[model samples]
Target: MARPGPRPARDHGRRSQPRPAPRPRGRRRRAPHVRERAVPALAHEGEVPSLARRRLSRLSRGVPARLRGPRLLRRALSRDDRRPCARPEAQARLRGRGEGSRLRGAEADEVGLVLGSTQDRHRGGLVSGIRLERTGALVTARFDKARGNAIDEPFTQELLQVAKELGADPGVRGVLLASAHPKLFSPGLDLVTLIEYDRAAMERFMRLFAQAVWALYALPKPVVAAINGHAVAGGCILALTADYRILRRGGVQVGLNEVKVGVPLPWSVALLLRASVPPTALTSVALLGRNFADDEAIAVGLADQLADADGFEDFGRARLEEFADKDTDSIAITKGYLRDAVLREMRARESEEMDAWLERWFSDGTRERIRQIVAGMGKGR
Candidate 1:
């Protein structure tokens, strides 16, 4: 009777190892609606090319919020409320918006410092993107995307901004233009903009971009381009803008390719290259449209130094610091003086001239040639 009452009590106290907690069934995150839909505003006072506006519009879409990339997000968010040449209130808004926004996210890890700002004191956007450093020297980020880093206007603007920061910052002694993109410098300009946008917009775009280039060239600090990979067309032009060009020994192919596009070089772009490399030496690179290997580029003065991709950053930084360590006062003053004449020419050039340049370049003849070449290469045009 006692046994029946007890009924072989189960060992409840045995306390089997606690069953593992159930795994969470994650819910999909809902994308927030655009709450504060501010019209895309210019981040700075200088002109933003219409081409850039259009390109940015397209780029802003499609890109995943998380994948928007730190540098680009900073550039977009750092925009000033004022359109260039806008009313004072607009300018003030822009000043307030400044590079502060760009410094907010994950991508910030890539940037070295904020160099350009609306106010003269901090002018931060000029150097607001990535600034990879090893030791005290500065380094550029290599290209990390596929389809390559297109040398579209936005990409060009990014380069210009970096240069502007370098010019503005008295403290930034040196910089390197390294690609995180594979086989990268850039593919070329957006053929779509060349063909689709009206001529006037193209001219406006050039003017804004030219001014930015001028700002970069005038930077007192030494700028080194570490070509981690290929540099085509606009990409080549960007690399040439640096004071010293270093290419990875076996992995680079670089040159200005306007001729291949059947387009004459924009005057301002031509002038930039001329200022950096000797005219005679640049002929084949610019006109023949042949992409030279690292050795050939160095032979023609397209590159000042060469190294394997592994050591390129280290070597470039050493060179940059060498120049950075110089008397910066002299450096800044001399750069300004050297660039004065060019700036005068750029300022004197007509907006119409730039428009005409784009018109002729994008006319039927050039368009067909570009189409043919792009088709031949089997890459999306």
Candidate 2:
């Protein structure tokens, strides 16, 4: 009472008197259809990785369908942010909603610059997960992300979506899947976060991962992997999906180490391994779960060719070009002949494999192992 209860809150009436409405000019403002895309548009600025992931979560719920269309996207882009905003040509792509069907998250800016517009522009902004650039008839998807390009939900989802787009586009003659990191292709799955996944969560991720890999494997076009860095565990499986893999022979660790970490390889991964690795070397490659060196990876058929440190990109491009010059239809048919079997086998055994995988993933011993690994990860990065 002596303090007067903090001076009592001031009450502002909704309308103290009849206020004049907003003066209408010659033209009426279209209000804001852009509000629907407000969340994603705000996410476009150089957002932190944690914030980016949250924005992507919203997109997964179908925010992309509300992509602000031409009106909203153009309106949003018109404002000069003093940064490298979307150019007119780029704006048209986003406006028409024709940049490969659906653009992921707020990649609206990056998509325009990276779609073979210019090299200098592409180098300026690094998008999360995968970055696709079309040079000539080949489309190169560089796997670049923060914290060593971990295989999270965003990674797999973007990959699958891009695969679908490239597969549908007739102009894309060949595809190159590589890592943007100079010395680390990918650290594989985000096991730190994944350690907390229950059976259902694990199943969902595994399912999406399988679809992404399958899309890459069955793309009906020549796909090459430039393994210029460490491709471990899940990363190794990604490389195995490609029709040909060119590995940089020095300072790179590559292989499947799923067993060592307590999770068994799922059916889809098994198919990819079987298709890529030589039958004689499958046991050592899949069972031992150790990183294969340059020569060993090649000998085991994990890699088709070897490239020097500087020539990694060229090495991949040359292979893709060689394939592109051929009769594409015949090439696709032959690839189908080899990999279609794997797809069939993977589909047939998907259920049982997932069942077994989930059982092992949630086991008491595995949880402890995962927890220990996750704990160690925080200390390093």
Candidate 3:
């Protein structure tokens, strides 16, 4: 027949397999569901991130009461506490705690040395060559420096800073200035140091020196100088700045020896001498540049009183107490009125006077005299 009709393509002895069904439009096939294993809980209870734990521990130790416990924890954990370590109070507290702990590393060693030595020395603050101690309304600043508490750039600056601080504090009623050295209040200006300065440097030094002197002279609170030892040259100038000068009874000498040293007295220093010294003795005291014994110092108005070493502190304290009952405002006002003319003159002539001082200080004759004096000191030592 017609080839048996294209006869159903011949059966090749194999059964036909059915095709897979098509996915529905707009619908994806779902993946098989997997059973996930649970993670185990931490071994300790109330566990937190390491950083958070550290923060909480610090807060618990030194933070204010209101900022401790859960309140602090909540704040620390919040996003708002991004810079928790940057808080000033927190930083200060942390520093205090660190100071209490053992010191390690270079920075810790440095800070520890300063804090420990200063605390031991004054139980207060140490600024350069000066050690300051505060007791009630009174502050005592003791000068202790190499070479007899010499008045150098650093010493002058520190003394000025302390004077300014005391003057600004309304609560500070009095200041006591004393020397740590037993035989010397101050050997005056450190000529060894001064001899090394150039003309410009000398000018700067004189200006700074004058400023320090004026700061102490004009301080509102009563200032008493306990001159327990020899105070010569610049030291004498310093003693005169105080409202009351109590010299310890001894062979210790006190006087302005600038003339002997081949240097002229600065105008400010001259004015101070005028105000403190007896008019009759001013010529001898200032012109001669002689060092006076405690008895003579008192007699000539170079020192207000004389006290034995054992009674030096008592004398100074007594002097300070003399003004204790006086009205602070009235006392300050009276002092201002008494010193206004001199202070005004000082302000007007500061630069010119300082220039003259520098000229004298850096002169060839003065330099040679200073060298000889230093050499003599070395030889004596």
Candidate 4:
């Protein structure tokens, strides 16, 4: 009996109570506001402004008054996702608010289909100067043989037709006046046509060439020039027509060296250079008729961008896609507005004024100097 009593006295008072049952693993305890935010679409699918206000109110509940404006503005404009995706054509067109040549041989076939026309084909030649690539929004100027890429009279006609078509099209988004020639964007104009023609035809050629340059300059969509090789004279003019120029690195010389070949830059082309290139560079270039290297061209505002020779396609594609992201209507309107100024300036300059300017600055005197320089450098062309 004594042993049993001793055992029963064993520390019942010191024993701890059994721990309460643990809460269920999946049952999370959340703040009330957090729970409301968890089902975002459900609470505010149709009430965007109201929901935004509610969220802002919640965010600013405890912040002092002075800090609220900055905080709210930061929240309003800040996008959770800034990465660009392939947007719908309409959406792609709205990104910005304000803001090629010929080739030798037969032309390439690079026309795209227009919407709803009996002829789904894009306008031939000039209108179809743009070629849409499969991988990106790359639209290169073609000089392939099939579609008459040759720089001849017939080809020029076709090119003009294409240009007219593009001008008329409301949906055309951008231009990339590229060339198929491996070494030359264009060898100036097709001398064959110009040399063979009489005075009347020569005048027509001049008018048409000027108009073509104007067309490129006037395109509402952003135009980027990608020169894989040399851009000489008329080709140089085409490059200048673009809002942005990217020259492939190395083995290329860009300038209006028409003086060397006994011609002057066209009036429209001269106006374009005046508008596009920096004043100093334009003077040195048009007046001197000097060849500018890639870096020099960029420095002079002749080339807005430059990249490695091998990466032209990738770079050009990205740029076009970026242009596509901008609002098309805004771009078109702004371009037209700016282009009207350029057109007026061009119209104001008389042919005599242009010729005199060229003669004073880059006449046969300069041409002979260039010839000596070229000979000294061992460049036969």
> Can you give the TM-score per candidate against the true fold?
0.62, 0.71, 0.67, 0.57
RMSDs, each prediction?
A: 17.6, 13.6, 20.3, 23.8
Q: After superposition, how far is residue 269 of candidate 3 from its true place, in Å?
A: 0.5
Question: Residues 29-147, candidate 1, lDDT per residue (tens digit)?
Answer: 33332212232333332333333344445556765554444344334443322322222233344465656333322223233322222211144332222323322334343332234
Residue 126, model 1: Cα distance from true site in angstroms: 16
Candidate 4 Cα outliers beyond 4 Å, as residue runs = 1-138, 145-152, 348-381
- Position 353, candidate 1: lDDT: 62
lDDT of 4 by residue, 167-252 (tens): 56565666666765677766566553344455556565666666666667777777777777778776777788777788888857
TM-score of 1: 0.62
Better of 3 and 4 by TM-score: 3
The segments of candidate 3 whose C-alpha lies over 4 angstroms from its true place after superposition are 1-127
Q: Number of clashes in every candidate structure?
A: 26, 0, 0, 22
What do the candidate models score in CA lDDT, each in turn? 0.59, 0.71, 0.70, 0.56
Per-residue error (Å), model 2, residue 110: 19
Model with the higher lDDT, candidate 2 or 4: 2
| Residue 3 in model 3: lDDT | 54
Report how far residue 330 has shifted in candidate 4, in Å: 0.6
**Which candidate has the highest lDDT of all?**
2
TM-score, candidate number 2: 0.71
